[model samples]
Target: MKKMNIKKILVGTAAGAVMLGSMAIPVLAAKPANDVLVKNWFVYNRSSDFAKLWDDNKATVLDNGGVGFTFNNVGATTWYTAYLKAHYNGDLTGKTITANVSVTEDNATFVTRGDGSTSTVGIVIKSAEGNWGVNDYWWPTNRQLLSALGTDVDIIASTSDSNRANWINICGLPATDATIHSGPDCVGGTYPAESPYDGFTNALKNVKEVGLSFGGSGYARGVALTGGTASFQLNSFTVAE
Candidate 1:
């Protein structure tokens, strides 16, 4: 009887370990098999924000010809979504991001984790702290903050600027057993209870990373390139306060 009890305890412990491991794994957002997976940049996505992934990131040079990269994020990943991100770290309070760039796509897809419009394409920012900066899933109000690109001003694909008026601050997602933002298009959804406009200002003051968004509205949360090819060409990008 003693031996039997020990055996049962061991088995139960093993089973519990397996269950915990399974619960830890998250769904594939833009992950493709190694044979087809091509990533030019690396970012840490915890569990919920998988819609934002890109195959390449580039920087320009002037002295000896610039380093130019013309990429099509469409069909580049498993979900047929792709983008080019130019990373930056700084304070963007009362500032505007201007870029000389163009995104040419035969098609586009826009999806939001919650209900909001899932819109905007121009400048994507992450805070140096909070969800924008943390890598752990349990972090507070963690999410990628977007600038008012399409709704406030349609400057994408041109040499214009991305405004930060009413930028989208995603709080909850659809698959996370949370309430959606209440809109389908970018800039159309109201702010979630957890994420308010005040949070946006805090994030901007401590901006960690910023990227040039080529996919309008659904810049990073959905199948932006569902049917056709999506290409992003960047010449110059700057932030003005």
Candidate 2:
């Protein structure tokens, strides 16, 4: 696959939520009209050279104003990441971030390796503690999250196999007890202590950006991307106060 360079452009803030394809991002003067502040994002796949796939056509805005992307030959170790900076200048310590995410497979099938383990997807939020530096906290699948939380959640049974759109909520951030509050339809959990940004309280206070990634590691290699294709979409991303 061809490696693409991801670009970032800071635009002015508009009156309403900025869709993926509409006008450029408006400046963040004050709090947004809605409870959740949304920003334009750029999505890319991890390249062989450990780079982000920059083909603009692969990641595009849908007619409904949502963001979408197509993945091909996504290796077991391969993963996709969507980068979006926070346009809200206010403190997100007590705020909650939520999104409606969906993934569909088109002629796509995973290449089973050892144990026929499947892949999972989830979100991550990073803070700007070191002056826009990296302090990221990952929220993997529910089973994974529960396991990290010292729960008896079954990892193998935690694979997200459906193509349904589910709302995921990451709440109580910037707090020591921050948690992933997604419903049964969705699978997610808070950042584990092993994460670089495990300090959720500190990280949430200075959140600068958020990421969405797919694939699994550890027991097996990862999600193998052989021949089929997968499309991912984020219907909405909101930060509630």
* Per-residue alpha-carbon lDDT of candidate 1 for residues 1-241, written as tens digits (9 for 90 to 100): 3331110000000001111111211111222222111122222211133444434323322121111222223332333222334334555665545444333333334333223354334445666443332110111121232222111112322111233333544432221222323334243444444333345545556666554432223444433322343333333344543
Candidate 2 per-residue C-alpha lDDT over 1-241 given as tens digits, one digit per residue, 9 for 90 to 100: 7553212222122233333332232122333233223334655434444442432233454432445455446554454332323333333454444444544554556532333445554555555434332224334333232112111111111112131112121322322233333333111333343223234445556556554544444211223446655544555555443
Specify the poorest-scoring 10-residue window by lDDT in model 1.
Answer: 6-15
TM-score (C-alpha, index-matched) for candidate 2: 0.48
Clashes of each: 16, 9
lDDT values for all models: 0.32, 0.38
TM-score of each: 0.42, 0.48
Work out how many backbone clashes candidate 1 has.
16
The C-alpha local distance difference test score for the whole of candidate 1 amounts to 0.32
Off by over 4 Å in 1: 1-83, 103-120, 129-164, 171-195, 214-217, 222-230
